[model samples]
Target chain A: MDIVVENLVKRYGNVEAVKGISFSVKHGETFGFLGPNGAGKTTTIYILTTILKPTSGRAIVAGYDVVREPHNVRRHIGVVFQDPSLDDNLTGYENLYIHGKLYGLNNTLLKERIAEVLKFVELYEFKDKCVKSYSGGMRRRLEIARAMLHVPRILFLDEPTLGLDPQTRIHIWDYIKRLKDEHGVTIFLTTHYMEEAEILCNRVAIIDRGKIIALGSPDELKSIIGNDIIYVRVDNNIDVCSKLSIDGIQSCKTIDGETIAIQVRKASEAIPEILRYLEKAEIKVKEVSYRRPSLNDVFIHLTGREIRDSGGGFIDIVRMRHRVR
Target chain B: MMESMYIMIYRQLKRFIRAKSRVVGMILNNILWLVFFGLGWAYTLRGPIASALFRGLDYLAFLLPGIFTTSIFQASFMGGISVIWDKQFGFLKEVLVAPTPRSLTILGRAIGDALVSVVNGLIMLSLGFMLTSHLNPLALPIILVIGLMVALGFTSMGIAIASTMRSPEGFQLIVGLLTLPTTLLSGAMFPLSNAPYWMQLAALVLPLTYAVDLIRFHLVGISFLSSVYWWLTPEIELLLLVIISVILIFIAIEMFKRTTIE
Candidate 1:
């Protein structure tokens, strides 16, 4: 493992931000920390990058203990924070140049690396313009350039495409994949976007309330539930689990208001059985559907609620209040 | 370590030079002061008090050095504004995460502000020379060195305060509150000879007083050293200023190390 965190604990006043979370990232692999808002993902990144000290437990990055040898850890890791960190007064080229100097790169190598990284992020032409003038996407690209200047062994990106437009977000995802494929740099990323993690990550750990709820490859986690999910809409708010006669059905769950989710071996067999039961009861079904379980479904199964909704109870109330107001 | 420090210092100096408005503001401030002197005290009395206070031994000449010192002091306090801006913009976190030593970052910013103050001091010196024929060209380098030391000392103090303060508005308010008293008591705006006993006592506690006294001694030959027994020698005042600067630097470094920005 290139990075290992054992029982990491961090607290702010009365709130325990991280409660003894433990995980590790292997070298040359993309590891995703998937979580919703306020789930201690950022705090974990802070500890791993040596920006904040853990109240207890141990974190080692690139073979150096974060607490005892933070400088060494810093040298091996590159980070793109959730917020942009470029100096508005300086040009993009100058920003990368100064960051290279901080890493003690020689002038020739620094210039070469800056050019290469700029081209990698496709910001070569805008290098001379002041960062304040850059668009949000352009600034983000520049930030990626700055982080890659030193060719660090590992790259940590926190919510890399949190608020980016879909097109720009896809572009960033491609850039990240290229970094891992070409340079062989290990990547540790945290994001709320499940599709991103499903596509990019070799392995992922679902974190909630400062604890790892589950950890595995996407396929492995999906296998734990079943192969396919049969979604049936029951009529008249009846109990579908008791009425439906479907074999190989692992469990039945309800979602939203009318949809009943069932995990079964074969969707074709389950759909016919469900139809037959409804026909015998002479009930008019609202709808029927079948699909594989996504990361969102896996998250719901592990946490007993949707990932975004788990801690967004307050946000729901605020929205409801606003709608009423 | 010193090489890295120098690099940090160079970056700061570059930023200061590039800020054209700041340079213009400094020059305009000195010119405004010169205009005040021309209108009020350019030609007054002729005696020891006049020599020491108004015009005999180059009264504006005497006043110029103090103004130079005050400008540097004000520049030091103004450096805190950059730190506050950095916090607001998220650049502070970027700098903090870098492999560079934390002390070097604070020192680099303080030195950057001090570099601007040095430029402002030189500009004031030029204005004084242009307006008065009694200016000594031979003492230029010595005066510049003293100006830098004074700037460094004051800038260190400012960095200490900046690292602890949360907002730019709050920092500016504190700077404004402390600026006039420190400047007046330290003989930057006036001579401390006829000052109240409490003011004189207050002056002794500040590093700027020693700086102003030293610059006044060199430019106008008014010996605050003879008047005050404690800082009667150049060597003693220089040593005291250096010691205070080191203490403030350590405090600033510690503050940088402990603070975490999101």
Candidate 2:
């Protein structure tokens, strides 16, 4: 295992940010924590990176205990923080050079690594420009380059493409894929974007309310919600949903006052049975639609709420700042 | 460990050099004080009473050491504001997560800021040296040494304060409250001899007073505190400054260790 977290918990005063979560990552594998904002993803990353101490339990990164042997862990792992951490006063090259030196890289090797990483991130032409002058995407790319300068065994990226344009985000994703493919680096990423997790990670842990509610490969997790979803709009959703325990229906949920979503083996076979059951129950069906289950459906199936709906409140924003910054 | 320290110091130097307006502003502010305040006061105090207070040396020479030491103190203390900047901008995380010892970060910052402070002091010293005939050219090296010590002590003090602050405005406010009184009480603008007993007592405890007196002794062949405490020799004063600097450096390092992300 490259990283092992066992029964880890972190509390800030009265709030438990990370509540007794445990997971492990294999060597050279790309793993991800998929969650909404303020779901303890950043807090967990901080503990594993040895920047924040855990309230209880333990985490071992790169075969070293995070609390007892943080220096060793730090030497072996590289991190790209959720926020921009580069020195805006320095040029892109200077930032990388300083990072390389802090990691105790010798001058000749440091220079070579700087050049290679900068080129890898496609920022070689902007090496001499001050980071303050670089655009947001450029800054993030530079930060990624700086993190990879020493060629650490494990890399942690927190919300790597948050608040970025779609094109820039895909570009960053490409660089991240290259890092794992070419360098054989074990990547541990935390992101709220479902597609980012589905596309980048070999496996993912779905965290919500400070706990990993589901963990598996994206396909495996999606399968947990059943292979297909049937969204049926009816005059009486609760009544129809209560009557949806027919043979083909795997699970049933009332989405709203007028709509209920049904999960089953196959929507083609399940929809006709669900409609007949609703008609037999004297419920008037308004509309019916079926589609393949995505990660969003899995999240709603498990948590009973959309992943994006749990964030964006004023208090959530404050709590997020407290946990991450 | 040493590599981290060197890298931090190198970063500070690079920042100082890149911020050209800041360097020019520091030098210009001190020069304005010397040209207007020093020259103006010198003309008003040309008689016997002024001569007795300054110990028969020109008033500009007496004020020279005070200005030099004050600029170093100001520059060094202001250096701590960078700690707050690092916190606000998120760069502190990078330093904190590095494998190097935590203390080395503050140490490197103090030394780096101290070097910049000394350079600023030297510019003021050189300009003042040309305006006054009482300063000896050979005393320049000794003055530089004294300024460096003062710079380190106050730079450490500044970093300590900054580590606890969250915003630049708050740090600036605290620096304002601190720098004005320390400068005034240390007798950087006037002779402490004719001041009240309380003011003299305050001056005696300030490290800046010792730094000014030592530099003044080398430049104009006199010490202000000698009249008050005849037993407080130059060697003892320098040793006291060294002790104070070391203590402040340790305190700064300890404070930095407690700095949280929030």
Candidate 3:
């Protein structure tokens, strides 16, 4: 194993941010922590990266205990935090130069690696421009390039595509994928974006409220929810779901206030029975849609809530931390 | 460890040079103070009693060394604001997670600010030399050494305070509150010998008071404390500043080690 975490826990005053969660990643594997905002994903990453100490527990990274050998773990891992860590006042090349120096790269090797990583992230042409002038995607790409400058064995990315457009997100995903394939680097990432986790990670632990509620591969997790999903939009979803009882339907969950998603073995057979039952019960359905089970469906099935709705509070906390009371 | 220090200092100097407005503004502020306050005091203190009060040297010559201490103190202390900036902007996270120890990071930042502060002090001294002829040109090297020590001492103190603070505005306010008392009590603006026992006692503990007296001794061959205590000599004062700066650097590192990404 490249990473072994056993009963890791962290607390802030009375609040338990990470509640004794334990998991591991094999060598050169892509692993992810999937959770909503403030669900302790970043806390776990912080502890593993040795940036934040765990209140109690043990995490070993690159065969070194995090608490006892933080510097060793740091030397072996690269991290791209959820927030932008680049110095906006410095040029892209300058930022990379300093980071390389921090890692004790000699001047010649540092210069060579800076060029190579900048080229890898496609930011070589703009290396001379200050980061303040770079667009959001450009800044993120530069951060990734900086993190990759030392070429560590493992990389930790916290919400790598957050607040970025879909096109930019796809571009970043391509870089991450190439890093894994070309360097055999083990990747441990935390994100609330279901597509991000599904596309990049081989195995994921679904965390909520400081606990891993479910853990598996995308297909295995999706299999936990039935084959098909029927999404119902109603004026009173809770009332409507309570009245409908159909055989093919495995479970009914009110995803949001007005939408109730029903997991079923076969949508074609279950849809008609569900509609008929809703009609006979005198509950008016505004709209109905059906699709194959997605990771979002799995989350909704397991938690009765959408991750997107609860996925945004972390950014607010970042802003709040910057403000003076 | 040395590599980490070099990078941290490199980043600080890079930012210092890039901010053209800050560079221009700081120099301009010092020049205005030198012209208005330096000349105004020179004119006001030209009488027989006032001349005796200035230890028989020109008032501008006496005040120049003090101005050097003030500018260096202000600039070096203000340099700590970068810690709050790094914390706010998230670059501190990158530094903390690097393989190097935390103390090296704080020490590098302090040394970087010290260098910048020394440069700023030299500029003010050069400007003062142009306005006054009483200073000995040969004393420049000794003056430079004392100036660098004062800069390092105050810069480390600034970093120590900033590492514990989160808000830049709050740090600025606290530094402002500190700068007033330190400048006023340090004999920078006036002779502490004529003051009351309590105020003189207050001035004795300030690192800037020792810095001002030492720099004045080199620049004008006068020492206010030579009559007060035989052992409080220039050599001993320099040693005291060194101890204070080293202690402050250690404290800054301890504070930085406790800082988290919360």
Best by DockQ: 3
**Local lDDT at B8 for model 3:** 84
**Per-chain TM-score of chain B, candidate 3?**
0.96
What TM-score do all the candidates reach, one by one? 0.88, 0.92, 0.95
Q: What is the two-chain DockQ of model 3?
A: 0.87
Model 2, span A58-105: residue lDDT tens: 999999999999999999999999999999999999999989988999
C-alpha root-mean-square deviation, each candidate: 4.1, 4.5, 4.1
Candidate 3 per-residue lDDT over residues A1-325, each given as its tens digit: 9999988889999999999998989999999999889999999999999988899989999999999999899999999999999898999999999899899899999989999999999999999999999999999999899888998988999999998888999999999999989989999999988888899999999998899989999889988875888877775635666767767667777655677777888888888888888888777887777888767777777787668632323322323443655
Fnat by candidate, in order:
0.49, 0.80, 0.88
Global lDDT of each candidate: 0.80, 0.87, 0.86
lDDT for each residue of candidate 2 in B101-206, tens digit (9 for 90 to 100):
8898779878899999999988988898689888888988887888888899999999999988899999999999989888888777788878999888888888
- Sort all candidates by DockQ, best to worst: 3, 2, 1
Query: Model 1: clashing residue pairs?
Result: none
lDDT of 1 by residue, A1-325 (tens): 9999899999998888889988889999999999888899999998999989899999999999999999999999899988777788778998888788778888899899999999999999999988879988888888888888998999999988888888998999999999999989999999888888888899989898888888999778776775677776656567666776656778877655456678888887778887887788887776677877777778767775566632233223333554699
Sorted on TM-score, best first, the list reads 3, 2, 1
